[model samples]
Target: MSYSKQKNKIRLNLVIALIVISLFSISAGAKTLTDLADRKLSLPDKIERIVAIGPGALRMVVYLEAENMVVGVEEFEKRNQQRPYIIAHPELTKLPVIGPQFGGDAELIAAQNPDLIISSYLSQAEMNNLQAKTSIPVISINDGSPGSMTEAELKMALKFLAEILNKNDRAEELINIFDQHKNELKSRTSNLDLGMNVYIGGIGNKGAQGITSTEANYPPFEYLGLNNIIEDDKKSNFTISKERLLLENPELIFIDQGGIELVEQDLKREEFKYLKAYQENEIYQLLPYNHYTTNFATMLANSYFIAETLYPEAFKMLEAKEKANQIYKQFVGQPVYSEMAEIFGGFKKMKLN
Candidate 1:
């Protein structure tokens, strides 16, 4: 071959190489995102399809206004239950179950060919393991554990999701709603001379617990500046015996919807007859906070309801369900108050004779 011919061929090959590099650059514009576990992930710029695992992962996605992008859901959410969001977004139940609860099926997840995975309530190890097993970038969210409700943690998760989903405006709006209402609650109750010893029962941790189950630092009680009758432990859910109930004789009582049946059963017992709250038919019902993991909207709604129950004069104009729907609209982009009201008879006074 002549030198001129060889040089021409070399120039053509160089041009081809340059085009390949440019094409590669166009495809490598993927960015890195940090999950709630603080793990760094390299992800594609456009995330159109998603699968969420762990506890309440889908719920968090729904709050982000990205539930339509979800390609799969956990089996638990697929069940025909009355969780507010579940009822609002019935189409989600039709999707394939990624796995039962937190135990994800990697094969199923990969089959969906999701661009991203959102896993809630998972440790760093479990998150990384799932990410590796499925070869999909996973974002972990912390929305508190079983019966523990932490606003700061939930805010962090919301902000993190907003960043990933590019929904900063919506995130800010939701955050503002949370802060504004929480401040309202604090301002209303901060300096009050609280004397009414309030007792909350039927607090569900794992599932529908008995009436004896309760929490030490119940969020709504803490917000309302009222004294929770049981201050013995700092645990989330612990059963205080009926004997203790008789000894304390709390001024007011509230039951979680999850354990309403158990509460009614306990009310039938002669042992509970002497309790002042029950005897006066002063038992009120509140939404279940732990069902399908912490429903942040319900938690805030219940807080408002508790505040009203504690100080009727202040919240006389504000109906609890109305306030709850406002919170729900801000958080989930819809007025879900009616569904919640239908679900377990939300935040109503129990009038059993």
Candidate 2:
């Protein structure tokens, strides 16, 4: 070969070596994360922007004070929703709707150019599909089930997710607030047996699910000394027969605002009218906690309200409204208690008569 041709061939080999090194370095420096689902994934070291899907997924982002990181939301979060997190972060309602859960559009998610995707809860199959379709790393943080977590599963989820987001300080502050209030509520009502079998009727699971909708082993009641009659009969969420309800005849029944209308409708029924709580008009209003997943702050506030209702003497110093405001302020950065209360009654006894 000519001398000049040999020199050019050597230069080409050096260029190839540099390209290979650069690719290897890029691959080597990638960060690895094990999400709550226990799925191992290699992600960019820096997660700048994200897309959140599934129930309460976007709300959890707000808790991290990381709304700035969210580039898109699901269709339902676009509205001026009642979830405290949604109410606090007005910017979320204006973001692009990446479509619904179960069938998120990868093209739409790609359009947002998110570096990560956060889901509140997703079946393993759903998680695999989302990650595969978008070619984006997806993490599921659960704080929804009682079996999954103590008090609020979302609370554990927040701390877990915050570690991943490098927001541990903020997560600690949030957890402290939850723990402090929960402990306070527990301390006062721990010993007092209100001697009352209570039923939280008119519970709304997804939306206004009517009067029959209720939670078994409700976290709020568990914190207080109250015994939920449903505790012995069921595990999670299930509607009880009105005939069975009449047989149990709980002394107190608190209605969730989400199911207020349905509760009112149920009150019109003669069968429901015969119940002890309905007869005495013990139905009171509580903010909806299950909407958009667990409203941990609201759950605490409602506990105080219930404690006060059952033992007015013990909680005379406490004001459920004030407590709700403090919790909302801490978690949401805005005390949206009044706004929510005005829309839906707060700790007020219903005058069904």
TM-score of every candidate: 0.86, 0.86
Q: Give candidate 2 misplaced runs (Cα > 4 Å).
A: 1-27, 101-103, 143-152
- In terms of lDDT, which candidate is strongest? 1
The digit string of per-residue lDDT tens for model 2 on 1-353 reads 34785688457545533432332223467866556666667777788999888776776777788888988887777654778887778788888878875335677887898898887667767777878888888877762233213343565567667766778799768876776787678778777877778988777655676666677878788778567777654456667787778888888888888888878888888888888888887888898877766677788889888888887887899888888888888887889988888777767998885
CA lDDT of every candidate: 0.77, 0.75
Question: On residues 166-272, what C-alpha lDDT tens digit does candidate 1 reach at each position?
Answer: 77677667767776787688777777766778898998877788778988877787767766789755676798888888899987898998888888888888878
The candidate 2 region of ten consecutive residues with least summed lDDT is 17-26
Q: How well does candidate 1 score on lDDT at residue 212?
A: 84
Model 1 score (lDDT): 0.77
Error at 154, model 1, angstroms = 0.3
